[model samples]
Target: MLVGDRGSVSAELVIAIPLVLFMLLAIVQFALWSHATHIAQAAAAQGLAACRAQDGTAADGQASAQQLLDELGRGPLTDTNVSANRTADSASIQITGMASMVIPLLHLPVHAEAAGPVERFVPDLAGGR
Candidate 1:
């Protein structure tokens, strides 16, 4: 009988397999989280842009934000809240939502904000070379 060689490989596998699988799952979860975060930020930015647009009102911005959320997710969105604000020279939007993971029993709460200067430009209609 060997001192430490008997079934050593099996023992190592038993210990290492779960650890490796856990690490892989954690990485996958993190990637999902990061992607959700980006989607949240993008939704907020789209809302803010819509709010700042001259053709649309705040409700339009909110609707756009909701559309963005829908595009980023499968099934229906949960607990979505959206708002936008405008000043004499500035505009901003805030979006809050929760994204459910593809895997059961997993959910990620997302909150984001987007703001930019509100400017109206008038281009010269006259043809110039």
Candidate 2:
């Protein structure tokens, strides 16, 4: 090794190790955020389906969403909020949560919304009056 370049390897390692670790952690964090978002979307869809049913209520939607979150959002997703709204013509469900952090001090938010027309029996479509 040259006298002046003797410590170059050590210096390079010092910079490279943390950079590599950070990149790896960033990839893992992205994955966690994606998974959390999927969970939130699934919960929202479940609640929306429940609330849009013929006899479904907003409370039913909220309960359904909260149950799903309890099952799946306990780890990858945290601090979840579930909301449902049902009106005469439409029903909607919203789920929001923070993705579990893999990188220190990095918090990612995940949100999902599902909405559809409320189910109803139509005499014209059902061939009955």
Candidate 3:
């Protein structure tokens, strides 16, 4: 009569492999999310820069952002929306989109916004009496 545990290691490996794979998938998803966020932020910054430049327009900002996304955001971002707004003193750009799903059936939202004052010459104030 032999009493021994022969399938313990194999069973453990079988159970642990899937868990490890899931963890790896989660890590990949997080990396994708981070990359998407950085791309969005960069796009927003570029748009803001365009809009805040001298003689810049909101349309120009929007176009700049859209171009960046179209060029660099192929696999990681989808359904992108770019908006640019300019006030009397400031300009802002916003990029919004959905991040690619690394996990099955999961969708993540990503957004980035950048704002700055429009560049203009301010005359030096002379001596006040």
Candidate 4:
């Protein structure tokens, strides 16, 4: 080891250690965000199915989404809001929330939406048309 560079390793570690730790935390934070997003999407799709059924109501859609969140989202997802709407020809559901925080002051938001034409029976029109 050169006498002029005797303390270089110590200097490098001072910078390298924090950088490595930050990278690891970033990876963990991203994983948590992804998991939270999937949970929201599943809940939204389930609620959309309930809302799009021929006999389903808007309340049913919201309830289903809330229930799914309660069952699956314990820590990763937080401050969730579920909304549902049905019109004459269509139905929709939205799930929105924040992912659990890992990096301080870094709040990640998660959102999911599901929509489809209302389920209904229609007579064959091929012959008529």
Q: Tell me, by TM-score, which candidate is best.
A: 2
Per residue, candidate 1 scores C-alpha lDDT tens digits across 16-77 of 99999878876776677677677878888888888888665677778888789888744334
Instruction: List pairs with backbone clashes in candidate 3.
Output: none
Tens-place lDDT per residue, model 4, 1-129, is 789999999999999999999999999999999999999999999999999898998999999999999999989999999999999799999999999999999999999999999999888889887
Ranking by TM-score: 2, 4, 3, 1
Clashes per candidate (backbone, < 3 Å): 0, 0, 0, 0
The candidate with the higher TM-score, 1 or 4, is 4
Worst 10 residues of 2 by lDDT: 120-129
Displacement of the residue 54 alpha carbon in candidate 3, Å:
1.8
Off by over 4 Å in 3: 124-129
Clashing pairs in 2: none
Q: Worst 10-residue stretch by lDDT in candidate 1? A: 71-80
Best by lDDT: 4
Candidate 4, backbone clash total: 0
lDDT of 2 by residue, 1-129 (tens): 679999899999999999999999999999999999999999999999899999999999999999999998898999999999999999999998899999989999999999999999876865675
> Arrange candidates by lDDT, highest first: which order?
4, 2, 3, 1
lDDT scores in order: 0.76, 0.94, 0.92, 0.95
- Tens-place lDDT digits, model 3, residues 1-57: 245777788899999999999999999998998999999999999999899988899
Q: What's model 2's lDDT at 113?
A: 97
lDDT of 1 at 95: 78
TM-score of each: 0.73, 0.94, 0.90, 0.92
